[model samples]
Target: MKAVLFANTDWYLYNFRRSLAMSLRRQGYDVLLISPPGPYGAKLRALGLRWEPLPMARRSLNPLREAALLWHLVRLLRREQPVLVHGFTIKCAVYGSLAARLAGVPARVNAVAGMGYVFTSSQMKARLLRPVVRGLLRLALGGRGARLILQNADDVALFQQAGLVDPQHIRLIRGSGVNCAQFALATRTRSADDERPRVLLACRLLWDKGLDEFVNAIRQLRLQGCSLHALLAGTPDPGNPATVPEATIRGWVAEGLVTWLGHVDDMAGLLASVDVVVLPSYREGLPRTLVEAAACGLPLITTDVPGCREVVTDDVDGLLVPKGNSEALAHAIRRVLEIPGLAQRLGEAARLKARTQFDEHIVIEHTLEVYAELCDPLAAPAESSP
Candidate 1:
């Protein structure tokens, strides 16, 4: 059978869903990948996967352009006549499901990774757009042969309460699944007694990601005269409305608050070097970085919010702090560093959790089961979540 997997960015499709595509091909699937044009499209093609560029914008809200994109997808689906279409993220899910229906496609899988800006942001624009977006979700996701995959239980309940889709149609997958082998506790050790405890926050610099709180936490720790090394990875997302400014990052560096290791290509190497990893994100479908760090056997620190808590249980595998509370975040980091054997204890628990809960092989198998449930177009959509 043939399947079409679509997302807003080629980078997302390549870095995140590449393994799923490859696995499908191995399982006798004619997997066709599509995304907006990006440097990673060629990377996907080089892997012997059939990849094509689609036209769309992440931040565009123009009605005419979005409609045109929807029509284009309808035409493409009609030509390909694929058995299933799986879409990642909000915009792609909404557009892909609508197009698949228009083209008379059988099954549609919509992965709403998070509530996203439309539902989460409190800005005037986001507030105004929520009702329209919510209505679209209801129309696209509640139809025949459609299932919605969410990362955390909180999101699942939110969708159910909102009556966006039937309760039976929701699947709670922990995350994209972390590559345990690629990110593990390999060369991370303290060779010198003088080595500072290094903590990292790696994700696109976005305001709602709690980047502001991360910086403030480090500052508070410094004021307490604690010896620490803070590392910041990933670059500012220019396309995102909540993206932190370059000048602001530079300012943090100037204040000796963090060492900006921008856009790391070797994440495993970096993870193996840091003692602790943190993502004070306000909300997430699930933050990929926390799992990757957990795989690396690093102590995890995150807010006590929905997706964040799914990965770290306050006193069990790792530490959890209150969101938007820099003081509490600072306290957690300090406790991990100052308490003897605490880091090692947390690290061991975190690695074990990663291998058990968020391993890629497990996630892929569960996801493939979802596909299998809907493989037969003539068959009705499965009522139970995978």
Candidate 2:
């Protein structure tokens, strides 16, 4: 059996789903990855998976370029002619599914990692692009052989309401679950000087991700004499339209209210050191930062949105503030800090939840089930190879 996995960014396929591909390969399936060449292209090849580079661009909405991408994807699908195709992220789900449909692939799986920009936009441009993408989704999912995989119920319902995919075709999986073994908890010991109440925000630094709201909340907290420390991690995403400005971030650092750590890889350790993990993202399929933080037994504070709500159980595992409300965010931050015992209780609850519900094996198993359903029954065995 053979499977072709499609993604718009090479980094995503390399960093996130590489394990899934290798797992499939171990199941006696030949894996072919189709993505635009990226920093991780050589890494993919090193893993012994076949890589096919396509000229895919992220965050670009040029209609002409998009059309060209569709045609190019169709051409690749025809050439590869794999038994099954699996596409990740929104662009790949839409375009790759359509191309696979056109190429007459036996089965296809479209994984909705997150309902990103389109769902969060209000501008005329966003309004114009929304229907076009939705229309493509409808076309991609119109066939009986296609299946849609959603990370969260909210996205599934949204697509259902939009008439994109049938309920029968939707398979719900927890947001690419974290490896519990990898993110172990640490001792809560700290010196008096380092014991100051601190909150950490970890994600791609984007304005629409509620970074501006978070900063504004810190400023509000300072004005109200909250006497807390705010820390920001992650890098500024240059390709994204909503990325926070470098100057604005530097200015926040200058104000002495927040410390910017840029981007560091040791996130599990960072979660252990902080008092709370906060993500005021406008939307998410499920923020991995929150899951990792919970796995490390840290309390969470996030917006009361779809994916955010899934990780946090308001007042149980974490606090849920209104989305885009700086004052509400400040109030929640203050409340969590005032009650010393609350963070401990919340953290304990979060850790239990992570262990019970978000195990990584669940994701791997469900994905493999999809692959099994699409396997070519007549394919020759290794022993029968000529």
Candidate 3:
């Protein structure tokens, strides 16, 4: 059997869906990866899977370029003739699905990782394009033997209400699952001399990620006589329009407000070194960093938004502050610091939640089941629209 996985970038494929691709390969399928070429493309090739570079502009809106992209995908799909075609992110899910149908692929899976900039942004451009994008999504997602995988129930409901997809075609699988074994509980002892707790925010440095708010919150805490080390990890995405410039990040680091650690590969080590993990993102499909941090037994502080709320029950696994409110975030951080046993309690609960619900194996098993059902009709009853 042959399967092709399409994504917006090589980095996303290597980082998020590497385990899933390996799982499929282990199951005796010849898996092919398609994405724009990058440093990570070589890593995918090194994993012993065939990697094909597909030139795609992730944020471009030019009609001629988009037409060429669709045509390229259609031709490539026709040449490969894979049994299953899986697409990740918005562009891949939309264009890929349409291309796969045109190529007569047997089964299709479109993973809507997040609503992304178009849905998240309140700009005039976003508002104008919303209806057009919705129409395209409806057309792309409407076909036989096609399934839509959403990371959160909120996204599923939004798409359903917009008439972009049928309820039965949607599957809520949570974030790309975290490997509990790899991100096991941190076992580090702090010295008596060091009393400050380490707090971290790990995500792509995007404006929409609320980095400014996090910095302001840190400043607020410091003014109130709270002493803690704040760290910002992850690289800025040049492809994204909302990317935080390197100069801005450097300025923050230079001012001693927060330590900027660019593109951390040793997340387990980083989590082990930190007392709390925070993601004040405006929105997300599901934030993987928070889930990984939870698996590593670190307490969390995040916004009370869709993806953040999904991972944390306020005051249960973590604290949830109002989105875009730096003062609220500051207060929550102080509360976590001041309270004697709150962090410990939240970390314990988070670890339990990650192990039970967001384990990598659970996600893999569920995804494989979907693939099985798609490949063999008799394996499960056909899903119907509600």
Best by TM-score: 1
lDDT of 2 at 117: 72
Tell me which residue pairs clash in candidate 3: none
Ranking by TM-score: 1, 3, 2
Per-residue lDDT, model 3, residue 148, is 91
Alpha-carbon lDDT, every model: 0.90, 0.83, 0.88
- Per-residue lDDT of candidate 2, residues 337-369 (tens digit): 988699889988998888777867777888887
Report the lDDT of model 1 for residue 314.
81
Candidate 2 Cα outliers beyond 4 Å, as residue runs: 185-193, 376-386
What TM-score fits each model? Answer: 0.96, 0.92, 0.95
Ranked by lDDT, top first: 1, 3, 2
Query: What tens digits encode model 3's per-residue C-alpha lDDT throughout 144-218?
Result: 688899988788888888889877888888888889878884466564786689889999999899999999999
Score candidate 2 by TM-score against the native.
0.92
Candidate 3 weakest ten by summed lDDT: 377-386
Report the C-alpha lDDT of model 1 over 1-386, residue by residue, as the tens digit. Answer: 78999998888888889999999999999999999999999999999999988878889889899888999999999999999999999888899999999998889998888898888898999999999999999888976588899999999999999999999988888899878988884576553764897889999899989999999999999999999899999889887889999999999999999999998878898888778898999999988999999898888999999899999998788998988999999999999998999988998898999999999898899888888778854534453535
